[model samples]
Target: MAESTAPPVRITSFGYGHCRGGLRIPRAHLVLDLRTHFRDPHVAPELRHMTARDQEVRDAVLSTPGISELVEATAAAVRAYQAGPTTELVTVAVGCTGGRHRAPTVALAVARALRLAHDWQAVTVIDRDIERSVIAR
Candidate 1:
């Protein structure tokens, strides 16, 4: 297949305390600091251990009061970044306290939204703490 021309969206999940080498892409156009926007699922006993990949954790995080708007806003930001003058790749780091629950879910949501906003754009989601990443599109 031919390589995509549009910019790629790299959504990263990081922890607040340990951010030394969190990024694999090195540089980011925008870092969506989601640390303050929503409640940390790590606080809830039942959901603490469950990762954002779980259906329950995802639903719970998405239900938070302004999460939809936040994700939508991220898509809008990506649109603006698409039009800006720079390298076509757009890197966004979405961070929470632990990178276990909130950050991962939000990063995934942002990736999904970016895909919807710009169909031609590539997307990659990474969880730095866990060293897991969905390879580029």
Candidate 2:
């Protein structure tokens, strides 16, 4: 008797307006944005006062009613992927005002959450703009 190996699972990140239409089958995509939830002036005063680097930002992002809802939505998507039987890959897009700070940070956090919560494999964070710049001639 011979043992079998399962195909690899992959997680990927993308920026706003980026697309991934050409990839082969057995892949899933999850898109997210900090600006979509955090750009409003109505965020809690306590969260407003916290610096972006503060751990409070993480807590606040996870707890904000709208953002938390989004997180739940994302979790559900991941769950669906996990329940399926296929070699799976997911590309999640996270957007913010600039590619430098909030977007990347939240994307990283989301990747961490997915891996920890679902025991996902191979999470990759990509700064789309940075990649574009590097590839530009």
Candidate 3:
């Protein structure tokens, strides 16, 4: 299959706590806040210390009730943006409470969805806050 000729896309996962002290969340054309709508794995002792890189964490987040649908919706949104009349890069910011679980998992899912749906060649996914110390709720 030929690679998509759409503009490049960048997806970032971040924690809301990291926005404290004058820090700003990454700018994006679309931002999905998973803090409230989704479950947090941090509250689970078994997954508390795990990042999205861990299969357990990814499974926990991906199994949430609305997550798969949201991933598809977000991928659709990115496709819409790409189909528009612009050549600028499309950025998507996925944020959760601490960025250790839900956000990064969803960001990665969205990247995969976009790749499969559109055969995109330049989608980049970044875990902006996954390595940071977990924020105490």
| Clash counts for the predictions, in order | 0, 3, 0
Each prediction's Cα lDDT score?
Answer: 0.74, 0.49, 0.92
Of candidate 3, the 10-residue stretch with the lowest lDDT total is: 113-122
| lDDT tens per residue, model 2, 1-137 | 23222233343333343333652221346555565656422144664434334676555555556665565577567666656687555455665543434555466665666666656445666544323321111
Residue-level lDDT tens digits of model 1 in 16-95:
64555543333566776667778877677797777887888899999999888999988788778877776667788877
Candidate order (TM-score): 3, 1, 2
Quote each prediction's TM-score: 0.81, 0.52, 0.96
Q: Show where candidate 1 strays beyond 4 Å.
A: 1-4, 20-26, 85-87, 130-137
Alpha-carbon deviation at 121 in model 1, angstroms: 5.6
Mind giving the per-residue lDDT tens digits that candidate 3 earns over 84-113? Answer: 999899999999988889999999999999
Pairs clashing within candidate 2: 28-89, 30-92, 32-93
Cα shift from native, residue 72, model 2 (Å):
3.5
Give the Å error, residue 51, model 2: 11
Return the TM-score for candidate 2, rounded to 2 decimals.
0.52
